[model samples]
Structures are given as C-alpha cells and as structure tokens.
Target: MMMKTIKYASLFRSEAKKVHRSKRWKPIFNEPLPIEVTGSTQYQGLAPFDFVVALLQDGQSLPSYFYVHPLTLPRKTRANIARALNKSVNEVQCLELHFDGHNGDHLLVYSSDDDANILYLIAIGTHSDIFG
Candidate 1:
C-alpha cells in the first residue's frame, strides 16, 4: 500500500491565492472614490495617511459601514471643522477610523456631498489630540 503525503506549504499557498483572488474578484463599489486632505496639519506626513488610503482602496470591495464608523462631533467642534474647511457645518458629517499599526490614533474623514466620489480627510490623532 502506498501513502500520499500532503505538502502543507503548498496547501497554504493555494488557500492564500484563493483568498487573494476572491478579494480582487469583485468590488462592492463600482469604483474607488478619490481622497483629499482638507489641509489639516494634524495628520500630515503620518502613517495614518497610508493606512487610510489602503482602507479606502480595500473598502471598495466591502460596505464602508462594516469598517468605517460614524462620528457625532460636538456642535462647537463641527463649527470649528467647518470653518477650517470653509464648508458649511451641515455639510460636515465626520467618520472615524481606528486603523491598525497606529496605537491610539484615530483617522477622521468625511465625504463631499456634491461629489460623492470625493473623500475629505479631516484629522488624525488620538482622543485628546483631536477632541481636546
């Protein structure tokens, strides 16, 4: 009787390939929207920027509600952000993202109402750094 031995590495590789292929097989959003920084110096030249971009790209295949969380900012904070962005307060609905690899850092963003395909990065910082 002959016994066949399975190669674990090959099996793992094949499974990984399947997962990768599936990720690229279909996109939830027909197209990924463009992202723009709203001139907030808080997140400039930071790791969170790269993380957010990747999230936006990968999130195209999944509903944003699955990963992106809605934020309810204080009336004062909303006014502040609106003033900085030169946008009306009513137009600023913030979203929060606690990305990996950045301990305690939060990424804040909002999508443009006029252009749904455009995303605006509002801020990136810890709880105090953002709200305080």
Candidate 2:
C-alpha cells in the first residue's frame, strides 16, 4: 500500500519534534555525494509548496546544516529530479531528498492527497533554476 502523504505543516512539526527530541541528524550519501540535513532557517527562496527549515544535529552546539520540508512534486517532475540525482523514484520518495547538481542543501518532495497529480517540492536552495 502507498503511504499517505500528510500535511506539509504537520510534517514540519513532526520533524521539528523528532530533531529536538532525538537530537540526531544523520547524513545519507546519495551516491557520489553526501546529502546533509540541517535545521537552519537562514535560507531565502520561493518554493512551489509550503516549507520550513530545520536543523539536523546530535546536540545543541554542533549543527551540521539545515533541511527543508514538505515538498510535494509531480511524478514526471519527480522522475526528472530522480534521474538528475542518479537515484530511483522510490529512493527519492523514500528519502525525501534530491540534488539539483549544485550547492549543498537538503530537499524534500512529497505527494499531495488532495491532488494526486501534484507533488510538493521544498528546499532551502536557490530557486532560480527550479522555480524559473
């Protein structure tokens, strides 16, 4: 069965709680590169979906970086993103991350229950390429 996509705001809240409670942010290497997760809110960009920045770390003092949340994108777009990242669609969906071939930022893409044809894309990187 397909996993139900929760609200973008709700997911952000849950991730914040998890990060604060566990204080752990593990980086997952997406083949040939390391994708760091951060909770910093200093990112400035316009996204297609509602998103928030959250830090990922093991403690309060050391913050590796920040990651954006609640990215719901379309399947075709997802596929294109997956290919760009040298990843499979399932990997992209399961991990909530995508590499735009530049910079270091954690990106998220989630499906929308209200609109099956739409997928939310959230990230803390420059939106000139994607949004343009």
Candidate 3:
C-alpha cells in the first residue's frame, strides 16, 4: 500500500480560516489535533482528503457521512496497539470514521494518552486490510 506522512496542521489552519471568514464561527477545538496517516492506498485520492477537510470545517458536528465510535479489536490487536503507543488497553480507546456506504474505507484514529487533543491516524483501508 502507498504510505505518506501529511502535516495536517497547515491544511487545517487554512481550511479553518476560510470557514471562520465565511461562516463567522469559531472552531470547536482550540487547536487542531495533529493528524498522521500511517497507511493507505485510497487516501492518495482527493475524496477522502476532502471529506476530512469538510469534517474539520463543520467543527465537531456529527454528520451523516461519518460515524464516531469506539473501535473494538481483538485482544492481540489491542495489545499491539497498546505496546506501540506506550499506553494501556483502557487508555487506547479508538475512534473511527465510517464513510457513507461508499468505498468501505475505514479511517482509524486514537487520541494520545498524554494529550487528548492529539489524534493519531492509524490506518485507512478496507475492512479486511484494517481488521483482518
């Protein structure tokens, strides 16, 4: 799969500024959380990237295009994530974006234990690729 690191801060700031100027609304988060895309092939396209941009622009509203919920993983998977993040299983609670019945691309993310505002983008792929 293709992999690349994205510095989302600049992107988010520009987008947020546009939203603020257009809508005269402040962003929900005081600061945009750091975003890291660990792995993905489809993410090379603009659809997912634009979706994320819109999500940020909306400022924390639960839109129909995505769902924010806890991720349930196997014991081994949980342990691996915990080890990698240097966090306990309980502290490793994850949230994901479920795009409306389109490409089945799952965006896995988790907040940093040290800083709740820091978000880590773990993976983006099909169900099998991400959880299988």
In the range 12-96, model 1's lDDT, one tens digit per residue, is: 2443344335533222112222333213333234343343454443333222423466788788877865664557889777776
Preferred candidate (TM-score higher): 1 or 3 = 3
Runs in model 3 deviating more than 4 A are 1-47, 50-62, 101-116
Question: Residues 19-110, candidate 3, lDDT per residue (tens digit)?
Answer: 34542222221222222321232323334435464434333343444566677766776676677566787778756665432334444343
Task: Kindly list the per-residue Cα lDDT of model 2 for residues 8-121, writing each as its tens digit.
Answer: 334444543443343222232212222242233342231212222111111122122233234556687667655644567765552243333224433443333222322333
- lDDT for 110 in candidate 3 is 38
TM per prediction: 0.40, 0.24, 0.44
Task: Report how far residue 83 has shifted in candidate 1, in Å.
Answer: 5.9
Error of 3 at 16 (Å): 25
TM-score of 2: 0.24
Rank ordering of all candidates by TM-score, starting from the highest:
3, 1, 2
In model 1, which runs have C-alpha deviations exceeding 4 angstroms? 1-48, 54-67, 80-88, 101-106, 109-117
- Model 1, CA-based lDDT: 0.44
For model 3, state the Cα shift of residue 51 in Å. 4.4
Residue 98 alpha-carbon offset, candidate 1, angstroms? 0.3
